[model samples]
Target: MADAELYAALGQLKLSYRECIVLQKIEGYSIKETAEILTCTEVQVRNHTERGMKALQKLLGGEIDEIG
Candidate 1:
């Protein structure tokens, strides 16, 4: 996706989910590192990432499988 469009999709996410995606996916942080930086449990990081990806995919009109 284009940069502005991608950022717009991310803007649609809840704040915590957006932070998780930015830290873990965009910044290339490990899951453990994301949890540490976000000051949340690893489970929370995982959950946010999952939901964020799903939401982003929906906003971007893309099909995303859980396996991805």
Candidate 2:
């Protein structure tokens, strides 16, 4: 995808600064690890990730897939 499309997808996800930071900056964790680090349940982390990805797909005008 083009840079603009990529950025637009990310932007459309509406992730808070903190959420984005946690997902992108930490980078070395499995979802479970990330959830633990964030002090949230694994389900919550998965939900956010699902929502974020869905939003991105919508923004990019791509097909949306079932989350998990």
Candidate 3:
């Protein structure tokens, strides 16, 4: 889908999840990098990215399959 649609889907998530997706996917940050930027653990970022991508995928008609 388009960036707008993906962004809209991202908006449906919780703030932390949205931030994780934006930092890791949109901003091209690795899990370690995202964790550092977000001041969270790498495992936390990983979990957020996984769940966020799943939610985004469901919202965008299953178009996202990267983070999982």
What is the C-alpha lDDT profile of model 3 across 1-68, one tens digit per residue?
Answer: 66677767777899999999888777899999899898999999989988877777788887765542
> Could you tell me the C-alpha RMSD of candidate 2 in Å?
4.9
Cα RMSD to the true fold for all candidates: 3.0, 4.9, 2.4
Candidate 2 lDDT over residue span 1-68, tens digit each: 66565655565555543363346334546777777777888787777776676666766677544322
Best prediction by lDDT? 1
Indicate the TM-score of model 3.
0.86
Query: Can you tell me which runs of candidate 3 are displaced by over 4 Å?
Result: 65-68
lDDT of each: 0.84, 0.60, 0.83
Model 2 quality (TM-score): 0.61
lDDT of 1 by residue, 1-68 (tens): 56787888788899999999888778889899999998999999999999988888888888444321
**Candidate achieving higher TM-score, 2 or 3:** 3
Measured by TM-score, the strongest candidate is 1
Worst 10 residues of 2 by lDDT: 17-26
Which prediction has more favorable lDDT, 1 or 3?
1
Candidate 2 or 1, higher TM-score:
1
Error of 1 at 14 (Å): 0.1
